[model samples]
Target chain A: MTDIIIAADAWDEDIEGSLLTWIYPDGAEVKAGDVIAEITVEKLQVDITAPGDGVLSHAINEGDLVSKGGKIGALA
Target chain B: MTLTADQPATTAPARKVVMNRAIREALDWELANDPAVFLMGEDLGKFGGVYGTATGFFDKYGEDRVRDTPISEAGFMAAAAGAAMSGMKPIVELMFIDFMGVCLDPIYNFIAKHAVHTGGKQDMPVLIMAGIGGGYCDASQHSQTLFATFAHLPGLKVVAPTTAYDARGTLHAAMRDPGPVLYLMHKELLGLGLWGTMPEASSNVSDAYFEVPLGKAFVRREGTDITLVGLASMTHVASRVAKTLEGEGYSAEVIDLCSVVPLDRKTVIDSVRKTKRLVVIDEDYRTCGVAGEVIASVVEEIGTELIAPPQRVAFLDTPIPFARPLEKFARPDEDKLLKAAMRTLKHA
Candidate 1:
């Protein structure tokens, strides 16, 4: 399983999590660097990308506040 | 051949540089000159700073000197303090000034008090740099220029530079000084080129390094009808308002209090004395902040001799709202400063 992690910069002192949208749904096949979600932090929208090519599984639901390095989903 | 009086004097043309590049150059100079000076902050190394102020530094200086610390503010702050005490001059970046709360003890209690506590025998030469201010709707937590709060504590030299020139000079001074300094940088003025552009702020900085004395207040514009005093981004705002009011023949003197702690009382008081009317515009909370301090200092120096009570144009005593209109209303701008100046000048 390949876990999709939020970029480390997302948890810098200025940012706080606001999960905006999930572009890829659970069980959707995605390419290794495909942007799977978009998260809002301190008024900036950041795209979360897929870790690998495989079936997608949601580790955390949409609208859930996420921290830096926290796994948002997985490709298995 | 005699130098012709008719010919224009040939002086080196001052190079125009942005605030971030000026800062990066300062860091480059410091790193090359001193072995003790190093930087540590989250995203500072690999990411070249969240605002790009520290870009290209990690490559030049390498990871040892240009470090990327964990997200724990307290942890890195304490480390910086420790390193400074051990004879290393560390330039620490607190991603945002608001996060100072997370590392309050080490910063205010330890690093600030170290010199006095040791009877001047020990000095903590640490520069705590942070991004401050709001306009792009980052909202309450991410936006704030709390220089006054840090200045309130004894032994801390709090400075906020509004232009590329001052940023370079003040930053060099902060790094060299043998004590703790809270160096606040406004995010909007980082010279990102992508964000808000202030041509005046982004230009006119000299290529050669120099220092703007920390405690001095710069008279951005000379006037006599009313005095408009401000710090950080508001300094530019005050200058703009001064120009706008010039159409009506109101000569507004704009004073930039470059360093808050070593409050340049003489400059501020002198301006107020001349104008007989003062309007202080601060980005910080209105109550118990620099605006009040400026007013009190002026009144303390001259009692009942003023033509009008000094006016304060600052953030309302409320948390900055997320919405644009509310934030605009809450924060002081050209319109607010203009009105405050007009109100103060009414009795003059």
Candidate 2:
């Protein structure tokens, strides 16, 4: 399984973001570089893309708070 | 690395937002445009509200406009009423609908009855917002959706929005109205990450100012077999059950009663007229709740048109329990709604 992480370097370290929505539903097929989820940090939204092609499984639900470098979902 | 400014990602073209953001946007727009509009609540400034609905207002509009108050609901509520009477629009946020018990006097007596008592000389344009809902084990005190209780009072417009789009629009409408408006925001639907998300409640909301006219009910889904009427969180439950019933060859129409006060009897009556079956769902207590009011209104208007006896799915008339199992049992759910719909269908 390849983990989809909200890269720590993407935003300020002190800020916490929320997983706004998962563009693709859980257990759906996804290709590498597919924008799988959207997270909002400090009113700005950042899209998380799939690292590798596989079935997408969400590690957390939408509206969940996330820190930098967290695994939002995985492709297995 | 792709960060967009206040916009949803390009991959998903729709500008969908959760209810919390939608409410904040509406408040921001009002605060920027209307000098008379101000906000007062506990922890509204800096803390950004309990549900994060007023996240950056303190910085955006300053403390004078986004004022935080002591933990006295009665004091601030009375103050808000006084401010409204003096030609100021005050948006007061009572953290929980359950908290209204301590401040009911100022609300019902002064705020609600100001215009009528003064013979239309004074207009109470106070917009009161409160959190309502129970699914995440917040216990009885913090969770009851007392929609009917507020609606029972005279001269108060009660609004309970189900979607982010409606939340924004209805809030704008409530603020603009020259009368007292009670806007109840469901805790679970706020998308605050404290409770699980209800994706169905989130929708594409525009950034521009808009108003969903007060006293109108929205038909979420159109069908002919049975009509399921719900408000706030119950609307979601009704919609889910409607989808499930559709698989079994049942067409269930879902109506979201956006405002409960001017209770849109026409929408309910029209939908029931077509379907000939009615199942009203509400999270509030069963006795004298919105569910009973809706059923009574429908039957009163078109008793002869009904093919089956109307059913109501609402919270059992008891204080909401803290236990997860008991809370689940007490509140209305998809199962209860589905069963109620089936009971209506049995007569057909």
Candidate 3:
């Protein structure tokens, strides 16, 4: 399984981003580099892309606060 | 240009952006494409707007085009009206919707009445952008979605967009229109990561220029059980309720009334015709507001055809209290919307 990570280096390490919503539904088939979820860090909104082509599984619920480098979802 | 579903798709890739960025991009496009387009508001130039919607515009467009006006709503609003009459398109930002009270004369008397007063000879191509809604503890003074107040007046077009896609398209459409348009942006949906985040508010918006035509109602979800009509923040609420009800074996059609002034009666009536029930959720006040207006229109069209009495979930007539819990109670929410939907279904 390839894990979808909210890259730690994308924003300031001190700020925790909230998973705004999952663009694609859980268990849907997705391709590598396809945007699957959106997160808001401070005032910036960033999209999380799939790491590989596989069935997507959500690791975090929408509106949940997410830390940098944490796994938001996984592609199986 | 007005964009419809039947229109040919552009090759431009869709980018996921917050509502504020989407608005900024639309304004940027208008400013770059048309020399007639310019911006004026308090803190718009240097401060980049209170919500950061105009960030970097001051530098990119310079002081001449991106102007910073004094904290005078009446003054700037009048100036914008005069500028529009003279063939210049001015986009004025009223920091908060609640402040409209201080500048009603200019908006109602001059800006809205210009075209009509001139026998269609003069055109008022002015766009008034304002921040509205109350999710954070901004009290009654700072947080009131007063789109209905403007909609009540004649000769003005009013629009409140729920998502980034609609925000970009509607703003484009509003800017291009020959008359004055009030574009109300809900503070909670601006994607500033303030108060709480609304994931659905952020969407994949196109980079290309397009217009989500005025006087159009977008059916966000198609269903047969009941029709839940909403605008601005309430659109998101109704959508959430619809999704939740889907799992409970109930189908609810969600209609986002993007343009309030025109009141998309046909779409709402059509949906109610199919569902045989109606529920309107509005952040605006219950009395003499969009909720009542929608229900009245639908009832006037097909009152006897409805399977059940329609329900309205909206803000209380009282001012939005300062306390968080009281504000929560006053505003239309998911629970309130769900209950209203369920009630409509039960009546049917």
The residue-by-residue lDDT of candidate 2 on A1-76, one tens digit each, is 8888888787865789888777677787878887667676754556688899898898999778898888887889
The backbone clash count of each candidate, in order, is 0, 0, 0
lDDT of 1 by residue, B1-348 (tens): 111112212353334455776787788878887899999999999888886667778988899999999989999999998999899999999999989889999998899999999999998999999999987788899888886788788989999998988998898888768899899988777754234545456655555657777989999999988889989888999999999999988998999998997999999889878888889999999999999999999999974768988899989889889999999989999899888888887773
RMSD of 3: 4.5
* Residue pairs with clashing backbones, model 2: none
Model 3 agreement with the true structure over A10-31: per-residue lDDT tens digits? 6865878888767767787778
Report lDDT (Cα) of residue B231, candidate 1.
93
lDDT of 2 by residue, B147-227 (tens): 889888788999999999899989988977889999999977877656656878788775777778899999999999999
What's the true lDDT of residue B181 in model 2?
A: 95
Model 3, residue A41: C-alpha shift (Å)? 5.5
Docking class of 1: incorrect
For model 2, the TM-score of its B chain against the native B chain is: 0.96
Off by over 4 Å in 1: A1-76, B1-12, B193-195
TM-score of each: 0.79, 0.85, 0.85
Candidate 2: residue B268 Cα off by (Å) = 0.6
Q: Write down the lDDT that model 3 would get.
A: 0.86
Pick the winner on lDDT between candidates 1 and 3. 3
Clashing residue pairs, backbone N/CA/C < 3 A, model 3: none
| Model 2 complex DockQ against the native | 0.12
Query: Model 1: DockQ against the native?
Result: 0.02
